[model samples]
Target: MDEKLSKLVQDRVGGAQPVCLFAYDLDRLTEHVRTVVASLPPRCRMFYAMKANSGERLLRALAPLVAGFEVASGGELAKARAVGGQIPVIFGGPAKTPAEIEQALRQDVTRLHAESVLELHRISEVATRLGRIAEVLLRVNLAGPFPTATLAMAGRPTQFGIAEELLPEAVDTARRLPGIRLAGFHLHSLSNNLSAPAHLELLDFYRRTVRQWEREFRLEVEVLNAGGGIGVNYADLDEQFDWAHFARGLPAVVDAFPEHCREIDFECGRYLVADCGRYVVEVLDIKRNHGVDFVLVRGGTHHFRLPVSWQHSHPFTVVPVEDWPSSAPRPELRDAAVTVVGELCTPKDVLAREAPVSRVRAGDVLVFSHAGAYGWEISHHDFLSHPHPEHVYYGDSA
Candidate 1:
């Protein structure tokens, strides 16, 4: 941990009310976003997926750095517009109501990704009613031995996008629609893809597929929305997605697709924000259950649910506390296997299971890193009506 973060954790640990905290390093997040933007090829555009961490501070900080924002719902679209005003916005989701479509058009979203053939017609009908031409990308669910991902959205039977076999008809429908313009294809089928080679290969597959489609349909492809699934290594902190390697290989990939003059867009969500946030929870009690050590904290899966969902021991660092309030003998576990759990009533509230911890006691803080994305937003905050964690932003007033 850096000096600033250490100080912040210490201050929180010693505060009046011992509360769970979600602290974001805005400086680190800004640098990371700028680094990603700087490394990408000129033909490649980066859009921050608003589903990751929609905190106002985060969104405002990133609005100026990224090319645009990709939103999945009307709420996200409004948030994007409010924070990223004038910056291009792409609306995408598996299920979009006609009202949402109309609102997106009214909000002047740059484009929309059509998930189904019926959705294409809906968008056309809505746009026609609004007397506007809606720019759309046909989201394709490719059939393949797809790349390895923590969550595979495509390469199987899923309701995410139009099936590969049915895309031809979808394209025909798009071309025939009065108020819709088939801009290109959206091929975002995976989540948490850790391999850079696999990602590049997937891009290659998309480019080839787009070329074949353009040839068959005799259509002009403008934008190829390569939906974001870049993975982060939460288990192995040292190992991560090789952004430098991916950037170095991107130019060659763009060069390979000379025939398709489509603008490539990456709507990355988790990869962009995960590393910037930390979930800090106070150790409330230390006990042993059947020869196994357990450290119960004030917060649990209700506050930070990524570890539970992934079933991986979330990497954490112990923030030692000097002052112990209780006069009783405070149990301390040293270099022992401990399962960190929350104050929830359910047994599924385990965050890190049987993980090695060095000298953890009550009042110590367990700082779970890589929690900026899908941390608070995805969690069931009102599960037991537990008090919400305090959201702290560094390098900016919040």
Candidate 2:
């Protein structure tokens, strides 16, 4: 523990008993999100990827910040709609069931990104049957070396969308289909780092492809959908995301295509809300065994998922209550290197390994920072009958 964190433990948790709790810094988190969004070019729109953390309160707080949402299922779309009316929403993913399509169409969403030819046909048929025209974006495949190794779908040999060579045929099919409108193009390649030149190159490729499509088909693209793999703070907190460079480079690419004045659409999930929330769990038991200290927390992967989802090794600064000793406990206090494990029955439920902290007791609190995005919402389940984690907003109410 550093000097500042040691004082924090003494101040916040000094005399109060420690129990499991989660909190969000809405103002700071939203400020950070605003800073990131501000760096984009004018007329560039961002759709908050809803899979990151769909807590109703969190969604409500973030709704006004972004242009719209990018949802994967009808359930997520419903959640978005529940937050308000006429929220611009788009549904992605492959092979959505008939009910999901109907729900999305009924919600009057902005667009749907079709991942397969069958899905395109299905949307056309359903929209026609319902006396409506569904605007769609055909997701394209960009085969290359992806940026992050942690992305599951990056290098996998799977068919999620149209191949690069087959896109023209698919566009022709869309042109022939009556009830479906080909609104734009979509590409969600697995690249995390937003390298200046490489990112520019990717944008140039899309712009060139869109231009070629316009020349070949004599149709205009309303949106150029460049999908999201923008990495958030996964490894280190000091690493700053280069938003200004991305903003500056993107306009340069779009400026090349003067006739293509379409909106630059971004579907970013993790970058929006990952750092706004923290996970706090109570230490259930503390023991010294085999020359090591073990601090078992009350929650595990069933609730706090990122510590396991990303194979994450970062431990948050644990602070005791205000009155707790800021200095080291008396030498009589058996201080040792502690490993924080969760209460789950499996051995894989470890949270942090070899965490260095003050001598922890059975009821101390452990706060996991940078847990707001893809932490609880994406990978959590009701396994072992544990209750779902609660979410709260801090700006207006708190």
Candidate 3:
């Protein structure tokens, strides 16, 4: 564990049983985001994808460092604008209500990614009603001979963007629309991509495809959004996405892009905030059932669902607590591989399966690492009606 994080876990999050807490180091998050921002070239813009973790504190801290926030819904747009009103916001979603289109125009979004031709018509109708020319990007789901990522939005059957063959029709419709300007293309191909070299290749693909589109459509492309897919390695912390190497090689990809293109946007979410937060929970019970040691914690997938959702046993550390307020003997696991589970009734509430733990008592705490992104944001907090965990920030984030 990082020294500061260890200190935070020991000093701030320490408590008795039935404790579930989310501890965030805002200063570390700010520094990390600033470093990521500085590494980018002039033409490359970094937009924080708010879908990963849309906490107000996170938005407020990230609003200044990032180029803008890439929002997907009206609520996200409102949150981004409320945190940093002057910062640019780009909206993208498969389904955009007419009310949302009007809101995006009224709030002055930089670009709205049209997922389908019908969505283009929707934007045009709403824009005409508002008497505003809406700048839009036709999101493309490319036919790919591409790398296999954690999740495939493009090069596969997905409801994310428009199909490759339908682009021409969408372009013509956008041009003929009364209150719309086709800004450029949005090629958000993958999710949770870990390879830097492969990502560079992906960028090359985007540049070539966009260039071909500009030539065929006779349209001047301004912005090419190579959507956020950079990943965090939960299996091995040392093998995280090579952002430095990716940043170093990104300029070459951007330099070869169309001269008419103004900005190449990288709206990263997980890569920005995955290392700054932790899910700390207290041990509720320790048992050996059917020759398997199980350490049950107070919280479960309802509070932190990344482990089950990703189908991986998340890494964690056992922080031993010496205090025992109970009169009964304290049971402990010694040099044993224990399966860590949560308070949920279902057998699917496992966190780490058969993981080696030196020692874990009933009153100890388990600190889950790399939990900053998609931790609480993607969880079902109200399932089972259990108490929500406490959010403890090390620094003033909001």
Candidate 4:
């Protein structure tokens, strides 16, 4: 366990009481943001993807550091505005209600990504009603030899963006629309991509495609939103994305399209905030099921769903407890392979499965790191009416 995390668990957990806790080290988050921001090339613009972790405390911490926020819905846009007043916001999603479009237009978002021809028409309609010139970006679904990713949105018939073949029609329609000003293209295809070289290659492809489109269509592109897909190494910490190398290599990629003269936007989510948060849950029971050791905690998938989603053992460290007050005989596990499960009734509530731990007993805290992003918000919080975890923010007060 990290020394700071160990101390935090010790300080936060009470004797023999099973409580779920999420502690975020804001100082670490700020430093991570600074490192990423400083490493980027002059042409690269960073935007925090609000969908990953929309916690107000996290948003407040990131407000001053990021170029702006990339939101998917009206609520996220409102949240971004609430935390980062007047800061630029870009909206993108497959489904957008008329009301949402109206709100986005009223809010004067930096750019709105048109996922489909209908969405482009809707934006034009809404903007025309408001008598406002709406800056728009066509989200392109590339046809390829796609990069390897945990989730691939492009290079397939996904309900995400308009296909590359259909982009010409969309662009022509956009040019015809009186209320719409076509800015550029948004090519966000992958999710959780770990390789920096792969990302660089993707950017190079994006630049070439953008330049080709600009030339073929005789259009001026002001921005090329290369959509954020940077991955966090959850399985192995050492094999993390080489950000320093990526930063160093970005200039070459940017310089390749000198004729394009477009601002490259990175709307990163998980990579920015994952390291700064810890999910600390106290073990309620230690048992053996069919010769397999099971360490049951007070919380489960409802509180943190990433492990369940990935179906992999979440990386965690045991915070040993000195005192054990249970009158019942507690099962002892030492250097054992155990599956960490939550209080949920279903078997799918496992957090970490068949992992070797030094020692874990009742009242011991299992601290799961790299949970700052997609930890709380993506969870099914209201399920079974179980008590919620305490969201603790460390560092400066929010």
Candidate 5:
């Protein structure tokens, strides 16, 4: 932990109740985003996926830095509008309701990713009813025998995108449908992808596939939505997806791309904000059970679910607290491989398993790194009626 975060842990944790806190350094976030945006090739745009972390403050901080935000639901759209009402937004989701479609059309989003034939029709109907022409990208689930990621959203059997074989029908229908324009195709193939070469290969695949479609259907495509599947490595923080290398390789890909395609949209979620925030919790107790060392903390999957959700032990560092009360015995472990757990009743409430540590004691604080995205946002905060962790935002977007 840095000096400021260390001080924050000291101030927040030590209370009677076990302290669980989420602190965000927005200055760090802003700088990281600026670097990412600057690295992109010309005509390529990044849309921050707000489903990752939609703290109004984060959205406001990112509004100027990013080209736009990509929202998945009407509620997210409303949140985006609330933060940056006039900023451009591309709306996407596998399942969208008619009311949501109507809401999107009324708001005049920049683009919509149609997941199925019926979704295209729904958008057209809604747009026609509202007297608006909707620009759409058909989300394709490519029939790929290609490389995959931790979570494959496409290029396989998934409910995420339109099947490869069903494209012709979808394309014909989109062209025929009133108040709808088939701008291009959306291929968000996978999630948490860690390889830059594989990513470039994927982009090449997209370009080739789009070219083939253009030739076959006699349609001009203005946009090619690669979607966002770039990943962040949690297990080994030192080794990360090489964005610099990936950015350097993009120009060649763009030069080779169809000249008519004007924009390449990367609506990334996890990779953007994962490292900007940290989760801090105080050790409530240390115990030994069934020949296993258990270190229980105030926070659990209820607060940050990324670990159990991915079934990986999240990386953390111990911050020792000096002021242990004299009344109780200080339970401590040395050179221990301990399983960190939370206050939840279920056995599944684990954060780290058999994680080796030099020394940790009851009252010490553990700070989980790279928790900015998909931490609290995806957690079941209401489960077991535990009090929510305090959110502390700093560094300019606060």
Candidate 6:
């Protein structure tokens, strides 16, 4: 780890000022990433979803391991390219304009995962106009009837993948299109709860589709993007996912297809970087109202931006900074139950409504975990024009 970064992490782990501490335990993160990679049968590729976290240091650390990049926009594509990343890149976004399609085709991205019929047509048009063939995959929607409690893709009104029924037709349409090739299929229906059965079902679905396509359309499938949604432990930090179990299941999916080894890609996002980051905020004023005490902080949803955007509830812990220290007595405060609030000037900017924290006062710092996923980048606005939080990556394994 850089000395500066190590000092910063130490400071947040024990400092006074409110700091958004963000660093994944790289050893643990890599263990998880490698396990996920190892689980796949031969020929399957895993791509890190870049929108999850764009910290340059983290990207540099993760670039060498994952198979490719799964980007949703042109800006993300540019960032990946700027870092001298050579992995195949896949673009996924429904409202892509003509210009974006043209740029993607020009760059010859690994694959463009087109969602809607209109976007598919636009990609074809752009490829035809550019006198090129855009390697593409059709997104499929295999959503379940009800929403799963966690952030699974089953029940959301997801405008992401094409309906399962429409996939075959979409594949046939791609075969007929002038400027596009039916490279394969793309799916992200189950967001972060991918069990072995889910993986098997998805692979089987594709296997049947491939056989049907080969027999009827005479088209061979080149790519099978079993989109990634491996869930991480946000609530319980101790229970590690058995990536070996997941890896054990990959071969079944790969062996079934036989020919397309290494062509299957996993679009993983949160599993790669969420555990690596932390958000630290300072305790401001402390007040007691009714039966509950409130500890105000210097950050908000406008700054951290996770609780509000994704309806997420993060875990909080306190580190002794200056206040009431045995020998480091500096600021102010004692111990009591308190709710944490931010300075966003919005009632909804509440960090925690029921945390049993100490009777905190101005200067004390509180740290929150699982902040690396959609923390600052999600629902940010210039509402109060708060300065963006400083993002530092920890290079050394913790």
Question: Candidate 1, TM-score vs. the true structure?
Answer: 0.97
For all predicted structures, in order, the TM-scores are 0.97, 0.86, 0.96, 0.97, 0.98, 0.85
**lDDT to native, each model:** 0.90, 0.72, 0.88, 0.89, 0.91, 0.69
The better candidate by TM-score, 2 or 5, is 5
lDDT of 6 at 218: 65
lDDT of 5: 0.91
Instruction: Return whichever of 2 and 3 wins on lDDT.
Output: 3
Q: Taking the tens digit of each residue's C-alpha lDDT, what string does model 4 give over 1-398?
A: 65666676777667445768888989899999999998888778999999999999999999899999999999999998898569899999999998999999899898899999998899999999999999999999999676899889899878999999998899999999889999899999999999999999999988888889988999888889999999988889889999988998999988777655668899999999999989989888898979999999988999999999877789998877877665777667999999999998899999998899988888888889899988787999988999998888887534
Model 4 stretches with alpha carbons more than 4 Å out:
1-4, 15-17
Ranking by TM-score: 5, 1, 4, 3, 2, 6
Lowest lDDT block of 10, candidate 5: 10-19
Query: Candidate 4: lDDT over CA atoms?
Result: 0.89
Error of 3 at 66 (Å): 0.4
TM-score for candidate 6: 0.85
Give the per-residue lDDT of model 5 (tens digit) for 280-381.
Answer: 999989999999999999989999999999999999999888888758999999999999999999999999999999999998899999999999999999
Q: Where in model 3 is the C-alpha error above 4 Å?
A: 1-17, 396-398
| Candidate with the greatest TM-score versus the true structure | 5
What's the lDDT for residue 377 in model 3? 89
Q: What is the descending lDDT order?
A: 5, 1, 4, 3, 2, 6
For residues 8-56, write the lDDT of model 1, one tens digit per residue: 8777776777758898999889999999999988679999999988998
Task: Count clashes in each candidate, considering only residues at least 3 apart in sequence or on different chains.
Answer: 0, 11, 0, 0, 0, 11
Residue 81 of candidate 6: its Cα lDDT?
A: 81
- Number of the candidate with higher TM-score, 5 or 6: 5
Question: Which has the better lDDT: candidate 2, or candidate 6?
Answer: 2
